[model samples]
Each structure stands twice: as structure tokens, then as C-alpha cells.
Target chain A: MATTEAARPIAVATTPHRRTRWRHVLTGSVVPRVILIVSCLVFLAPFYWMVVSALKTNTELAQFPPSLIPGAWAFNNFPDAINYIPFGLYTFNSLVITVGATIGAVLSNTLVAYGFSRIQWPGRNALFYLCVATIFLPYPVILVALFDIFGRLPSFGIQGAKSWVDTFLPLIVPAFFGNPFYIFLMRQFMLGIPKELSDAAKVDGASELQTFWRVILPLTRPAVIVVLILAAVAAWNEFLLPLLYLQSNDKYPLAVGLIFFTSEHDVSYNLLMAASTLIVLPVVIIFLVAQRFFIEGITVGGVKG
Target chain B: MTAAATSVKPRSVGRFRLGTLERRNLKWGLLFISPWAFGFIALGVFPILYTFFLSLTRYTGFRSPTLIGFNNYTTMWNDPDFWKAAYNTLYYTVLAVPIGVVVAMLLAIAMNQKVREVAIYRAIFYLPSILPVFAISFVFVVLLNPGYGLVNLLLTTAGLPSPNWLGDPAYTKLALVMIAQLGAGQWALVFLAGLRGIPIELYESAEIDGAGAFRRFRSITLPLMTPVILYDIIIGLSFGLQVFTSAYILTGGATRGGAGPDNSLLTYVFYLYQQAFQFGSMGYAAALSVVLFLASVILAMAVFRWARGWVFYGGEEA
Candidate 1:
């Protein structure tokens, strides 16, 4: 077999334009175009409102007849948002948690997933199924217990009786042990790699680890990229775990940090909206920059099952 | 010489005996995968088994769980809210999941069209999925705020009476279901990928066999895509049962008060959150969690069993 080949010429063939006259009239007609425009508007409306609200002052935003666009674009609102919360600290905290967790998860889960997919080790299937089955276990169920477990670790002399909540232990440690979802994704991707490639590597006197590192790892970069994007997005959007575990205001991620600013006493809608807009900016930019790779990664690796 | 070497069998101790290299690889594999396996057995499996045991007991946060022998299970039998929560969840799942799958599939199929400006369109459609649920929730609240809300405003303009969306019990679930489906970007992309997987030759052959578009989809497309559909169904169902943040946030968090008006939007997870954190009934909340777990496992196992009948593999028989 012509396996271990780095690249193959992709044959691009255009989709046949088999649009019959009636079929074209029915689907490619003006009516469908109008509907599409309307649908697009419906989809875009909420996002537009978020942007518009973020830019408007409280009085302007709270008006009876809603403003489609802000009267005077309050460019200051974005700057005001920074002071609304300890935005810098929150961003830093979020960065530490997301980056650390994603890096750890990708590293750990890839190795575990690779082991399961490539090796015919004993109890592997049972272990993989165990991981899959745990996918349905609600986090809330084990959270209190996990906290208890974390609390007792002073016996091991790690934290010296400090609550794990104040530290990034809860968010960071669970990730170092492979996440089930990422493991599943990596396993799927690994399975798709032809066995012949690895066999050929072995025939050339390569060990399993060498084949994994030099051959498989390099080849599965797309899947790894996908995992990275997913891990980052998941860590970013994560709220419940952070709120449950992280205690100090300074230690808060952006998602949880913003909540403190919107408490009942001074729920400044303008500032809240501005902060919300700012919180989403990083994610939006990341999405845009990695648009092609992200979609391919998610659709191919993450989304399948 | 190479042909002769290939023809010769590899030297081995015996069929039952492992070579040093193979043993080393196996040991290395175990070492490499130890984190997951250890975590699984230690954290995952232990907690699950412990929780199963704990569900039978009345354990508060600080105390040892005393076994009550199905007292919790009996309580669920009589608890109106248990049934109510189940009904509400099932209602939401039924309305949301299929509509979500269909709408997502349709959106994917539509976006898969050959057109310029498609990337922007894709981004526009997918924007909601990545945007924080908080942002979307706030936007929806403002947009569906009964009086000055855009949706109600439009409804009133069309001479139709507008109902309270998040406020009223009758429309609360419907409103949630509708809003939930709005974030179909991820699912749409998945379906789009699955759509690409169906061999063009199969569709073309169906067309040549005088099958109409609908017929071709039903016969060839649906059968081939059954695995993806099954996967989505399981995932959608699991996620549907865990509807918390939206309902919790919409009800203005625990501090704002209990789940939306008349407990209309009180999902199982939301209710569990209330009981455990807000009400300080950790024991009761843990029981509820177990109940939710059981429900999810049963549903998942059912889907898996059903997959044996309907989900078509590429080469394997169902």
C-alpha cells in the first residue's frame, strides 16, 4: 500500500449545475432570496442588539422606543468597562486558567487517546467505555465531594490547609488527567489514521513511541489544533466550575468577575453591557482568526459524536 | 533477496509468549495511559459508585451517610415536583431537540450552498453559538420584555395578543425551547460535515434511478447519515436534561428569587441548584442529582440499544 505518504493530490471537481428550469424557479427564485434575507436578519438581530446596547448610555438604552443604533456612539463605554470590574486581573486569571488547562489537557488527553487507539493493551476497551459512560455524570454531583477531596490534601502537605478555591487547583488539575470529550475526539482522529503507516514505521525499526512522536503526532496536527481551539473556547466560556471553586474577586475569570459588577445595588446596564461585550471580544477574535481551522477542527474532530 | 526475506516468517518465541519489545511497548502504553486509567478508577468510577450508595442514604455535607433503604426513591414517587420537573424536562426536550436538529440540518444544508459572501454568512449564523449565553440571555430579555420588547412589539403590531415569554408559565417553556434552538451554529456545522460525508455517487445513482429529491434524501441520505443522527440524538438529549444556566440566569440567579414565574422554567438541574446551594438541602439535592443521572443513563442506554437497529455503519450490518 502507498501508505506513509505525506500528501496526495486533492482532485477538485465542481458540483454539476443540474438546475432544471422549474427547480431553479422554485429554489433559486426571488421568494427564497427574500426569506433568506429575513432569516439572516433574525439570526443577526441579537448580536446587533448586544453591540448597540454596549455602545448606548443607560438613559438611551432604557428608552421606550428602542434605539436601533446608539444616538451618540459612546466610545467611552468600552474604556469605562475596563474600570467597571478589575478587568485586567480577571483577564489575567482567565488567561492563566484557560491556557494552563488547555495545554495540560491537550498534552495528557492526546497521550491517553493515542494509547487507547494505537495500542492493544489489556482492559483498554473497558477503560474507554468507562470514560464514555462518565460523560453523562453531572459535574454538580461530584463537586462537593471533589471539594472535600481537595480540602483534605493538606495531609499530603501540598496546599498547607489552604482551600483549593483560592488557588487554580480545581480548574487546572482535572484537565491534567485527560478530559473525556477531548479523549474521545483524539481517539476518533487516531482511529482514522491508517494502521499501515504505523506498521511501515515499525518495519523501519521505529519503536511505538517514536512512531507516535515522529509519525503520528506530526500528521495529526489538524486534530491537535482542533483540540486546542475547543479546549480554549470551553475554558473561556466555563462559568459554573469557576464560580463553584474560585472564591476571591481578584481571582475571578471574566465570566464570573462580570457578575460582581452587576449586583442589585448598581446594575449599570450600560457598564454591564459594555463589560459583556468586552468579555466576548477575545472569543470573537479567536473565532475569526481561526475561522477555517476552527470549523474544520470542530466539524471533523469534535462534532462527530 | 527482499522477496525471500518478506516470505520468511518473523522469529518469535511462541504464540503465547511476548517478545521483549512487545512487553516494553505494553508497559509503556500502560505508563502513558496511567493518568486516565487511574483517574477513571479513582475519581470517575469511585464517585459514581459512592454516589449510587449515597443516593440511598441521608447524608448532609459534613456527616456520614446513613442508609435509609429507598426512602429517597419512595419520596420521589410522591413528590409532585419530581414528576413536574420530569414532565417539564421531557416537554422541553421533545420540543427543543427535534426542532433543533431539523433547523440545524436545514441551516447547514442551506449554508452548504455555493455562494459568495458565504464565510460572512457562516460567521453571522455561528455568532450566537460562541457568544456568551449571558449576552444572549440579556439580549433576549430586552427583546422579549413583554411591553417594549421587539418580539412582542411586532406581535402587537400585527393585531395579535402578545403573551409574556419568560414571565408566564404557559409560554415560558415554549420561549426557552425557541431560544435554545437559536444557538444551532455548532450542530449545523456538524450536520454540514455529515452531509459532506455522503458519497455523491450514491445520490447520483438514486437520481438516475428516478428518485426525486425527497425520495433520494429519505432512502439514501437518511440511511447513510443514521450514525450522525443517532449521535446527535444522544448528545442533544443529555444536554437538554442539563438546562441550567439559561433558566437560572433568566430567573435572575438565586438572589433574584426562585425559578421563573410559577416555577414554569424550573428544570431538574436548576431545581437541584436551588435546593443544594440556595436552600441548603445538600442531601435532597444530591438525591435529585442521582435521579437525573439515572434518567440520563437510561435514556442513553436506550439510544444505544436503538442504534443497533437503525444506525447504519459504513460496511457493517446494523
Candidate 2:
């Protein structure tokens, strides 16, 4: 197989120009098409299995030589899965964290990016390098110490809060501080804007913030949207932080809550799959709706790195 | 003053005596970046230092820490479970990173094909990369069930032996590797971008020079992709070392210290979590974390140094 694939290129290269077109169509397209089609099936199979398992009956789920298609489409399983766990409450918690984190990510990253890109200040590049270097610092390195910091938050004189440990603050508040990755993305995008636009706004008697707000921010809409989607998706899929911080069942996001549901309940494969589908549906929809930004953000990050 | 400062280049100004506009710009720049600066200090810097401090103490969550010198590190050095966790983590990283890179590179090449349904194929491949890892883990739990599972059924049909994927110690880490491949699409996208950046003219020129497609790919495409490949490997190494969530979920996390059948699935971070939260040995976990941090930094540095020989920058002579 490998030899043939390698030999085809030589064959095509040496072939007569008129005949080469037919050879290209036959050899070039066929192999790639077959490879891609097989790959597509392999990648999509789990999703198909996930959906089919979600719709299967308990008896059908337990059957040996498991049927490829669900024998019965138990649509009620969706509602049942929701009822089996506090799905509504978990969804609300997930929403609160996702929205809070997304807003914080966009606002903080844009402001920091503006500072790093538009303003020419002493030590700017040095500070930006420090910011970028934080990307390599593994999260576990900070996990224990941050937990201690948050666990001791009440002692530092924040009124009415007992501890930051059990609250959504730990997960959401950090986003307000600016993630290094998002800051990098926003800075790269902001750097591409013509300097004349900000200068014109400044010459019209605008303050730096005003010029940023009026001229630069509007131009950075695409980058902001990219940051927004990435942040929301990240927050939605976050498991470790939530698993560590939120102690109460009521506060658990869908990511952590699903684990609680499975561990506490007897194994119900169908119900679990149904719940998994429900949790994954929103992310799938978000990706479909704003996929361009996701790809743009990823490629930009990859290329820059 | 503002106009004068603007006329003179900011870098050319004296260190202590700044121009009016330069000073103003400095103030606003600091102001704009204050949030991240505060977070960087409070979260990033402070925590790292404190983690080192905590690693030297004997503390539980409820009580104050007592300084214990280097006892925690000595204990970690002697602990067999610690070594086991380290070994398991190394095993996972060594196997998963290279396999993932190859799969991603192949997928990128396939996606770059001129087929009409390429968009659909790209989307299909990339979808699994974005779905929550925990959800994917759960899906695999059923798919790899020893009895009546889809995988086992397929294996039986093919007259092949299907070892218990999750139950057996030998196959547990491999199961996680299989799960890791689901996210290859994410890197595949990155590789796709790299592939796109390679000039088509180079291939055309090579073809006219009687270079086969294989030769063109070997010489022109592979050299150009070295930088991206280096980036992917570094990122993959870090991620591979930090493999926690899937193992945690698969091994039944709520059971407390369930590290999967004789601790075959006890990844480094998972062990750290068990020590810190599950067992309430905060100080010990801090030591584990410090080791992880050092290892990561050292390995990354080693890779970068090693890469000097192979990584081809486009502007440089290869």
C-alpha cells in the first residue's frame, strides 16, 4: 500500500501531460477520498453510538452483540434523565459560571490587549513576555496554593462571605483577571489595526480609553467574538476546578454534576448517555453557530506559538 | 508637550526623564493592564512561591502548617506509589504524544485533499475534539465494557482477543490513550493551518524538476512543518503529563482514592489530588506539585534545546 502510494507520484510526474489529468483523478483523488471517508466514519462512530445508546431501552442496552441501531427510541429517557438528577439546577449553575466567565474573559482580555498593543510605554514588551510565559505554567502547580488562598479568603476581611471555596467566585473571578491565551489572541488581532485610526480619534480630543472605546474596540469585534466563544466553551467544559471548588451538589455545573449522578446512582448506561447528549448538545450548537471563530482562534494560537 | 513627545521616538528618551505623552501613555497602559497584573501577582506568582513554601510544611486543611524542612520530598522520594504514578504518567506521555501527532498529521493531509466533501469531513473529525472530555470518557466506559460492549462484540466477530480494557492493569493506560486520540482533531486543525502555509509553487517547481510527490512532501513540506510540529509536541507533552480527568472518571472518582485496579491508572496529578483533597495531606501534595512543575520546565527546556538541530525556520538555511 505504502509503495504504491509513493510510486503513483512518480508515475503521474512522468506521464504525458494530457494523460496526467486522468491519472491524477484516478490515483490522486481515490486514495484521499477513501482515506477521508474511512476516517470520517471512525471519528463519527462514537457520536453515532452515543446517540443510539441514549435512545435504547434498558433491555436493549444490556443485550449482547449490541444492536447498531436502537431497537426502541425511548425519547422519554431524556426527560427521565433530567428527573433522575437535578438537571435543571445543574444547567442553571453551568449557565451562571459560563456567562460570568465569558463576560469577564472578553472584558479583561480586551483591556489588557489594548494596553499591550496600542500604547507605547516603557517596559511594555517585557511585561507582555512575562504574561506570555505564564501560559507554560501548569495548572496543577497553582492548584494547591490557589486552593489555600481561596480557602483563606474570608480571613482577609471580605464581609458576608464565609469562604470563597464553595462559591462560583473561584472559577469565574479569575477570568476577570485575563487569561494569557486570550490576551495573546486579542493583542495579536489588535496589533493589526492601522495606527492612524487610533491617532485620528486621539487628535479629535479623545482620551486613550475613549479612543479605545470608540475606534479600536469596534474594529476588534471579530477577535472579541472569538475570545467570547472560546471562553464560554472552556467554562462549560471545565471539570477539575469545579470538581475541586464547588462542594455542594446544588452548586455543581453539568460537568461535575454528571459525575455525581453516575457515582451515586446505579449504573444506567442509557440514562447516562442521554444525560451526556444533553450536556454536549449546547457545545455542539455553539460550535456550529460560530465555528469560524473557533478555527480562527485555534490557528492563530498555533501559528503564533 | 504631547506633540513634542509624539515627535521624538519613545525609545530614544532618557530613562528617568520621560516625555509628557510618554508618561501619560505609561500611566494608562498600567491602568489598562492592572487587572491582569493583579491577577498575575495574586494568582500566578504568589501561588507558585507559596506552593514551594507549603511543600516544606506539614499541614492539613483545618490546621496551621508546621515547618518540616525537606521531609516531604524525602518521603516522596521513597514512596512506591509516587514512583508508580510517575511511571504511569511517563508511560502515557511517551506513547500518546507521538501517536497523536502522527494521527493529526495524517488527518490534516487528508483534510487538505481536494475532495468536494472536505468541509463535512473536517467538521466531523473536529467535533469530537470539542465535546467535553468527561462525556467522551463516559461514552467509552460503555463502549469498552467487558460484557456485551460494542468493542468486545467487534473483537469477537473478528476472532480476536479483547482484554478487559478498564479492568486489567496492562490495558488501563492504553484505554486512556485511545480516548486521547478523540482530541487529535484539535491538533489536526493546527497542522492543517501549517500545511496551508506551505507554498504551492514549491510543489509545482519540484514536480517540474522531476521530483515525485513523495519527494516533494519529504523535502519541502516536512521541513516547513517542523516549527508547527515542535509547537504541537511541546503542548502535547504538557497535556499528556497532566492527564487526569479521564482517568479520574474512568476509575470511579467518587469512591475516594480509586486509582483503577492496582493503581495502574494513578496519574501524577491524580495522585497529587488524592493527597491534597481526598487524603487531606495538603503539604505532601504541594511537594508532588513542585516536582511536577520542575519536571515540566526541565523537559520543555530539553526539548527546545534538542529542537535546535531539527526545527527548520523558513528564513534560515536548512
> Number of the top candidate by DockQ?
2
Off by over 4 Å in 2: A1-23, A155-161, A303-305, B1-16, B316-318
Write model 2 residue lDDT over B142-225, tens digit each, in one string. 889888689899888999998899999999999999899888887888898899888777876677798987898899978889
Name the runs in model 1 displaced over 4 angstroms. A1-22, A28-37, A122-126, A136-138, A155-161, A192-211, A301-305, B1-21, B63-67, B114-117, B306-310
TM-score of 1: 0.87
Which pairs in model 2 have colliding backbones? none
Q: What local lDDT does model 1 show for residue A193?
A: 93
DockQ of 2: 0.53
Per-residue lDDT value at A251 in model 2: 86
As a whole number from 0 to 100, the lDDT of residue A140 in candidate 1 is: 62
Give one digit per residue, the lDDT tens place, for model 2 in A213-293. Answer: 989999999999999988988899999999999887788999998875566546888988999999999999998988888
* Cα deviation of A272, candidate 1, in Å: 1.5
Lowest-scoring 10 consecutive residues by lDDT in candidate 2 chain A?
Answer: A1-10
**What is each candidate's DockQ, to 2 decimals?**
0.30, 0.53
